[model samples]
Target: MPKPSAVTEAPSVVGSRLRQLRQRQGLSARELAHRLGISPSAVSQIERGVLQPSVARLIAMTDALGVPLAEVFGGPEQRDEMPEDLTGFALQRFGQGTEMTLESGVIFRRVSPGRTPGVDYFVSTYPPGSAAHPESGMFRHEGYEVGTVLSGELTIDFDGERVVLRAGDAISYPCSRPHRIHNTGSVDAVAQWLIVHPER
Candidate 1:
C-alpha cells in the first residue's frame, strides 16, 4: 500500500475549532452530545484534543453546529485571506488549502476557497484498509454526495449493496441512506468529493 503524506497539524487544532464553533452556536457540550447521541465526556474529550473524532462523528458535529464540514478544517480562517467585500470568486493554491485528517486515517483536504453555506468541497484520501465510518458501520446524514475517483479503488457500501470505483469513475447518492466509503485496494484511494447539505 502507498503511504500517505504525513499531515502535521495536530488533532487539537480541529478539537479547539470545534469547541469554538459549538460555543458560538450557544450549545453546551452536553447539549451537543445529546444531539449527536454520544456522551458529554466524548464531546469534552474531542474538544480537549484527547480524542480524535471519526469522519462520521465529525460530520455529525458539524451538522449539529450548523456549519459546513470544511469549517472544521479552518474554512472561516482561510476566508480571512479574502477581501471583505469579495463577491465572485475564490482561489485555493496548491497545498495551501486546509485539511483535517480523521482518526480513521481518512484525510479531507478542503478545496473550496471559502465556506458554501450548505455545501462541502474537498479531496478525500482513503488510505489502504481505511474506512470512513468507524467499526465497519454505516453512516447516514442529511445531504447528497458525489465523488469522482482520481486514483486507486474506492468502494461505496450502501443500502446493502457494494460498488467499487476506479479512476475516472463517479458516484452520487443521497446521504440519508446508510453508507460507508472504504479503500479496499492496495494503494491509496483519492477522490474529489462534494456534499450538498439538505436545505434547512
Candidate 2:
C-alpha cells in the first residue's frame, strides 16, 4: 500500500518559508492575512517563528501563497539555532514617568539599552490628544523600520501620506522616508518596533 502524504513538523522552518513566499509574491502581512482570513498579528506571529499553524491553516497558507505544502514546511536551511544573551541590560522600568515625552501624551523610548541606536526602537503608549514624538523632527535613519500596533491608535507619516493604524495592524516603512509617528486617540495606544543595524 502507498503511504499517505505527510508534512513534517517544523515550526521555525515553515514560518520562515511562509514569509519568504509572501515577500516573493509582494504581499504584505496585512494583505496575506486578508487573504487567509486572519488578523495581521496572527500572520506576523506565524512569520516570526512564534506560532505554528494547524493542518487547516497550513492548507490555507499554501493556497494563498500558491506554493506546495511540502515547500511550506520543508525549508530548514537556516541552520541550528544559537544561544541568546540576556545580560548587559542597564535598566528596565514601566509606567509613563520613565518614558520619553514626545508630546502631551506621546511617549517614545528604546525598548532596551545597548540596542541599535539609530534603529529608533520603542514601544510607545499614547493617550488621547497625545501625538507621536516625531511630530516635528520627522527624522530619517538608515536600515528598515517595521512595527505592529498591538493596541489603540497609531499613525505614521510616510513622506507625505498618513497611514492610520489600529490594533493588530502592522507597517513597514523605509527609514529613508523621513517618517514620523502620531498617536491620535482618546485612549491608550501601544506598538512594538524592530530596527536593524550593524551591531547590537
Candidate 3:
C-alpha cells in the first residue's frame, strides 16, 4: 500500500498554522472570531486544537487571512515563493481579502494585495454598538485617512468635534488628531477606507 502524505489535516498542525497566521496579521482571537462571524470562545477552542474547523470554516479563514489554501496545509516551506507578478496590479475577489476584527468589533478587510508603500486600503464594517476605541476614547496614528460610509450610520469624533454620517457620506482628516468612531445605529455599518502613511 502507498504511504499517506505527511501533510495530513491534523488538528494540532492546523491550529498552530491558524495562530501563526492570525498573529502575522496582528489580529487578536476576538478579532479573528468577529471576522469569522463566530464567537471568541470558538476561536479559542480552534486555536488550542480543542475543536476542528469544518471545511467551510477553513475556507473562510484562509480567504480572510489572504493566503492561499496550500499555505495552511503545506506548512512554512510553502510560503517562501512569491508570485512573479506580486508587484503589479492584482484582483481580489469578493469575500477574499485580508481581514481582521478590532477589539471593539470593527472588521477591516484589506482590499489590496502586496505592499504599496505608505498606503493602506480597506473595507471596514462596524457592528452596531461598536466603537473604534474603548469608551470611544481618542487615539492618533501617523497617517491620513479617508473613508465613506456605504451603509448604516457612523459617528466620528475628531479633535473634540463630532459628526454623524450616513450612506454616501465621506470624511477625510489627518490621523494626527485624536479621533474615534462609533456605530450609533442598530444595523451593521460598512465603509471603504484609504489611509496614507507618512513617508518614513
Instruction: Compare the candidates by lDDT and give the number of the best one.
Output: 1
Write the number of the candidate with greater TM-score, choosing between 2 and 3: 3
Q: Name the 10 consecutive residues with the lowest summed lDDT in model 2.
A: 74-83
Tens digit per residue, CA lDDT, model 2, 46-95: 88768755423554575677653334422343111112353434333343
- Between the candidate structures 1 and 2, which one is better when assessed by lDDT? 1
Estimated TM-score per prediction? Answer: 0.90, 0.43, 0.58
> Pairing residues by index, what is the TM-score of model 2?
0.43
lDDT of each: 0.85, 0.59, 0.68
Error of 2 at 75 (Å): 43
User: For residues 72-145, could you state the per-residue lDDT of candidate 3 as single tens digits?
Assistant: 54356534433555554555445444454444556656555444455667677889988766654575655688
Q: For candidate 3, report its TM-score.
A: 0.58
Model 1 pairs whose backbones collide = none
Candidate whose TM-score is highest:
1
Number of backbone clashes in candidate 1 = 0
lDDT order of candidates, top first: 1, 3, 2
- Prediction-by-prediction clash tally: 0, 0, 0
* Residue 13 local lDDT, model 1: 87
